[model samples]
Target: MLNRNNLYFIRRKVTNHIMLSLTFLSVVLTVLPLLLIFYYTVTKGLTSLNLDFFIAMPKPVGEAGGGMANAIVGTLILIGIGGAIGLPVGIMSGTYLAEFGNNKFGNVVRFLADVLSGIPSIVVGVVAYTIVVLPMHHFSAFAGGVSLAILMIPTITRTTEEMIRLVPHSYREAGLALGIPKWKTSLVIILRSAWKGIATGVLLAFARAAGETAPLLFTALGNRFWSTKIFQPIASLTVYIYDYAKSPFTEWNDQAWTASLILIALISLISLLFKFLTRSKY
Candidate 1:
């Protein structure tokens, strides 16, 4: 057998080596792509970045000056509507899964949720087109919002359930011991404790929904004019970027790059907010 001193030295050396390797790998895997994306976007998109891009409406194809204000507004409206439609339903479903669900029914619901999460965004757009756009006789922002809501729901439900599950069982026991109703305990005590996690999930869902282009393609129909009406077809930032990027015009391409940069910034901000919200205070 090795001497105690030698054994200790060997173990320490092995552990330090392993930790160094893991740290290096983690840095490479996570930081490299983010740095590259940021560098590329800032370099290319900064040229077209201006206040007018955020304030003015899109002009005709050959027009000298224009902006994506309409698309920006429409994106916000669609995301807001989607959040309104999905948030409560997802939270309720998650509450059921974490608190009340069991056995076969819960399993089936979970499977369906996972399946929905995996479905392609384009397929969702197709379904929305058939059900809402076709039946209504026109594409509208509402239909696009509904499609995004469908995509958001599964993500929120899964995250909420996981967050609720992470709450300590001791809390539940204490609530029960106090003779609190089970529903009240679950909603009030458990959910409150898990609020940060739920908020993180909601923000993540919003980020994902905001970036989706396929669902809005057929439903919103990509307008160039400012549209405040929920019942009217509208343009969104994602669709605008996608369409403009493919155009031959240099100006349109520049706008696309700028819009993409803005979208990336928004997603990064949301992610940072989630991290801030979830960071331990102590």
Candidate 2:
């Protein structure tokens, strides 16, 4: 008995309600896993947290009260080296792809990036082993950084390309109209306009690299003692966690939990810092 307009309105409302419910469900699915990970990590890891965990070296097996200070420092060094290698290369490569991507060579580069992005992390580790580790005659932090940088490149390149492409073409024209060179306009106006998004990509690449362990295994090789040399084996949070979690020692297991917490905290802090940086400019 309803009029056609009334029927159409009712059907539209029902469709919208259904769509809204689905969207909410998808959001919950995405968020619930993250929330669970945070809860589990915090609860289990808090019991083992202590000052020595940050300042002191790991005690000899069967000893208690050692910290992951060396591991923490080693991670920082690896990330720094990797970032230095990857960030600029990724940015430049991405700019090229975005600006000059409508060509055969660009298609090849895009194909390569896509392939690398899908490659396994362990496969990258093996490749690094064959190349960097073998040439050096031993595992080293330098090789580990190289491996991580390789993993980061495709991702950063893609993200940077996408972010740069998102900048309005009008900006480019405006800069050109002002007598700016194409390269200068791209760097000064276009890049500045999209800086926040590009930074987010860099941070994301950093985070992804930080979480890898297999690549380090074939390269850094895990040092138990403090080693500042880039060519020397070094500890990282993920590698340290791997070693500790496998040990029969209850104390080592507890320390592993603490290390897990610390790694999570460090990554979270980095993410928050970048988030603030992005928002501050906007």
Candidate 3:
């Protein structure tokens, strides 16, 4: 026997309560784990972080006052090389998928990209080791870069394709109506329009490659010394963390924590940069 006003008020209250509950649940599910990881990393890892940790080389097990310079350099070189190999190929393939490859060949390529994306990182590492390391008779930063490039290609290609597709058809149509060549329109107008999304994808791909350990495990083989040569084995942060954390020495473990913190910070900065870049574009 509720009045109409009472009934309406009750419905609104219930809806608001449901939305509040959902919002709380979502926040807990998403933010809680991230908070916990940040807390743990800062607590365990920050203690080992210092100027020496960044500037000097790794010391013997019991000694301190060393840095992760070699590892940091190796990581940069590997990621740079990987991006160099993967970026152009991925962008071109993605452009084709979205622009001109609208046939059976395109479908097959898309399917293969999907499959490649799903393949495990360790498997990719194994493939790289077999094909690159074994054949070349050495583990090197170049091999690790090639392996990471393989992993990055699929992600970049997929993201590029989707981002390009999101560009309004009207842009392409307008370019065509202006009598611009089709290739020029697709490359210039459509690509510029979706550049933000593509840039975001590229940043994400770099972040993804930055943390990869499995591929580098076999391909790079974790050198302790600074290596300027691409053909020589190089130590990366991921492999350094893995190797140090598992060692019997407590100092190595601390160094591992410091390196892990550096990695988390780097990835977080990249993600924030991507967010800012995309937001600015809009």
Candidate 4:
């Protein structure tokens, strides 16, 4: 039998070991599901991934061996337009909130942005449908882009505001002390300092917009063939995944898995890029 002092020391050692084991177990549990998802996606999607899947147009129903080249291209186009619209507007709003947000109107603007961010994306799609699709009397890529940009605006706004606020007020004062205009100081000193963080926000918004399907359904309306005109219908990866996954055909089903893999990869890449950019010494 050990002395009481030795017993106490053993108890502390055992407790520490147990706590460490629990921490490692928790990590494993968290990572297990992600590992399973990646394994399944790779196993199922690899067979369907081919050169033709990137180069060829989507085939009609009852056909075999087709690709989502149009959807790929359209997805890029919609995101491009959405980012263009959201980036400047979001940056401006964020700058306003950060610099002039002590007032009641600024509070109202921030509240509105929070409300907009929380609104369901499907609801934004409906609003865009009413404003753009109905007015144009057609389902067009422009409407889809508008819907995505609406979804992106709030996130970008909040992120930009947060990043700009992190810039030391001393930097602002220094520029102003040099007799620079407030606007010029904001643009040159504050915004430039926070550009990397803003870029992360923009990339995150782009990834989110790329994955949306509901907004595009009633807006872009899913083109089967290649279409470059923003005024015309367009294909999108999310819509294609939705349409193909529910089909009875085995090939389309496989393609859906591949599309899912692509989407997952794209999102992960964006997140990784954000992590890298934030870690960099700008």
Candidate 5:
């Protein structure tokens, strides 16, 4: 005996509840895989976690009691090299695209960036090998870094452009109205405002680069011992994980899980640190 209006209202309420439930379910589904991976990694890795694992070199085959100190340092070094080459280029390219890219050349650059982003990481590794390793006549950390930088550039460039574009046009007008030069305004007001987003994008690129193993396989070639020279092969957590995971030894298998845990932890720590450091004061 409900009125038509009451029936319509009931239907609307039911629809809203159903949609909300659906969205909640979707979120749960999206997060479940990540949670499962983390749980399994933590459970398997904790047994192998020790001070030695951070301080000692990899043990010889069929032996025990070793660490990944060299791999850890090498990973940091590679990241440094890649960031040095990639960050400035990406930020500058993105700034140009956002501010002055409403033309054919900009379109071409944007298109190229998109295409580069879609290219497989292994393909990029091969390209770097051909360009760097072949010329040098050996695999090197430098080659690995070059491949990582290439992968980083496209993501950082597009992210930078998008973050900058999100800034209000009024901000630009205000800076210009104050008699600030266009370049200075873009550098100071615009960039400062968009820095948090840009930093997040940079961190994302770093995380992706850190996780890449195939590129390093073709470039760095995975050293077993310590090596700091840029021109020499270097170790990395991902490579260690790859090698250990494929080994027949149980110790190596355990270490692989530990290395995976370490890689995930490292990326998470860096991301949190970057976010904290780049948080807006105002």
Candidate 6:
């Protein structure tokens, strides 16, 4: 009996070591691709990254020494528009679902949100085209913004609901005992407590929207020159990268790499900003 027990203990120790090794290997495999991509992008993109790239407009065909100023501005504008339309609605919807949505209607809304999240982005773009572009008889930044907003909504709503739900029931009860109205408690206390997670969700949504190309293809309809009007075609970094990468010219290809680098940098900066904003004041 003593010998048998010793053998079993040895076997369990070996099995645990094997599992640990496998998990470590899996982590390395997962991170390797991301590291390689970042290295490759930086190496390739650095050749064309410069002040002019951020300040000047795209040069005409076969020309050299141009930038993506308009595209950068347009990308920011699109995100701003999407955030303006999507944030409040998503937060409010999530609050309702978490606070009062325990029945059939809540389940239906939750199901719809899940389905919406899974839908292809290109399909959303097409829907926006039909709803916004066709009526206006042309593609515009507004249509692009609408498509991005739709994409953002489900992620934000679901994230907000989960984050709010994580708040302790005691906190709610305490607020009620103190005579605070339910609406005020939900808005001021619950949301404030969950704001960090909600902000993360918003950042994720913004990053996804910023990188989208297919949706904007059918909506914003990339422009060559600078244009900021909501009803007009707009330039965006993803679209510019798409167009530039496909071109036969070497300069454009270099610019595409640089543009990709800028997009990544922009997203990173926004992430840092969100982190800073959400840092605990205590």
Q: Would you estimate the TM-scores of all the predictions?
A: 0.88, 0.91, 0.91, 0.90, 0.93, 0.95
Q: Which lDDT value does model 3 have at 58?
A: 87
**TM-score quality measure for candidate 2:** 0.91
lDDT of 3: 0.90
Question: What is the per-residue lDDT of model 4 for residues 1-282, given as tens digits with 9 covering 90 to 100?
Answer: 999999999999999999999999999999999999999888998878998888889887788888988988898889888888998999999998998787999899889999998898889989999999999999998899999999999999999999999999999999999999998998889999998888888887888898999999979989998998999999988999999999999999999989888888877887887788678665
Order of quality (lDDT): 5, 6, 1, 2, 4, 3
- Model 1 over residues 50-141: C-alpha lDDT tens digits? 89899998888788768889888888899999999999999989989999877789889999999999999999999999999999999899
For lDDT, the strongest prediction is: 5
Model 6 regions more than 4 Å off: 1-6
RMSD of each: 3.4, 2.6, 2.4, 2.4, 1.9, 1.8
Please list all clashing residue pairs in model 2, or write none if there are none: none
Q: Which stretches of candidate 3 lie over 4 Å from their true place?
A: 1-19, 272-282
* lDDT tens readout by residue for model 5, 188-243: 99999998899988999999999999999999988888899999999999999999
lDDT of 4 at 55: 85
Superpose all Cα atoms of candidate 5 onto the true structure and report the RMSD in Å to 1 decimal: 1.9
After superposition on all CA atoms, how large is the RMSD of candidate 4?
A: 2.4
Better of 1 and 6 by lDDT: 6
lDDT to native, each model: 0.91, 0.91, 0.90, 0.90, 0.94, 0.93
Candidate 1, poorest ten consecutive residues by summed lDDT: 58-67
Indicate the TM-score of model 4. 0.90
